[model samples]
Target: MIVRIMGEGQVELDDAHLAELNTLDDELLTAVESGDEEGFRRTLGALLDGVRRLGRPLPDATLEPSGLILPAADATLDEVRKMLHDDGLIPG
Candidate 1:
């Protein structure tokens, strides 16, 4: 699946990585729900880091459609909370 970071280009990630990402997604959800800025930042960073670790970055010119859209690292709690789905940012 191709995932897009709001301020960055898209990266092609395999479905095999979805489970791990979902675990991080849960942390994000908890942070959002609890209105914890630091937790949100930490969890969001972990999620993005995991994505980068498991997927290669795409060139800026790449135009493939994205299956998932992640928030930017500097995203505010409200912004991220609004982006949440039933399964968090990246659904498992």
Candidate 2:
């Protein structure tokens, strides 16, 4: 899955890659918890190399609103909820 963080960056990862990285992360954390410096260093080195190869840094950017005005603070919760629900803006 490729997760794109608007105005932040993105990560493209396959299932196998994700699983491996998760395992590596877990191992590194475990080593850190156990005070195993050597193990932690090895796992961290691999993780950094993988990131250097697969990750591309995004250009700095800002997120500008789409010119949509939000409801006033004085608006009641129920009224705002109804507007969002009727507009199909809320998740079911």
Candidate 3:
């Protein structure tokens, strides 16, 4: 799966990592919903770190479509709130 971390370009992540990412995504959604800025930051950091740790970086020139898009570490809670869908940032 091609996952894009906003402001950080894209990475090619294995499908096997989806389940773990989704778990973090769910936590992110919950944190946003409950207005927990700290949790939001923590979860978002974990999610991004997980992607960086488990996925390979795509070339800067790569322009393939991204399967998922995640907000940056500095994103505001309200900003992230608007990005959520019924399935959260990472769709299962």
Candidate 1 residue pairs that clash: none
Number of the top lDDT candidate: 3
lDDT of each: 0.90, 0.43, 0.92
Q: lDDT tens string, model 3, 27-73?
A: 99999999998999999899999999999999999978999888888
Check candidate 3 and list the clashing pairs: none
Better of 1 and 2 by lDDT: 1
lDDT (C-alpha) at residue 59 in model 2: 38
Ranking by TM-score: 3, 1, 2
Please give the range of 10 consecutive residues that has the lowest summed lDDT in model 3. 66-75
> Model 3 reaches what TM-score against the true structure?
0.95
Better model by lDDT: candidate 1 vs candidate 3? 3
> Which candidate would rank higher by TM-score, 2 or 3?
3
Residue 81 in model 1: shift from native, Å? 0.7
TM-score of each: 0.95, 0.44, 0.95
User: Clashes in each model (backbone N, CA, C under 3 Å)?
Assistant: 0, 0, 0
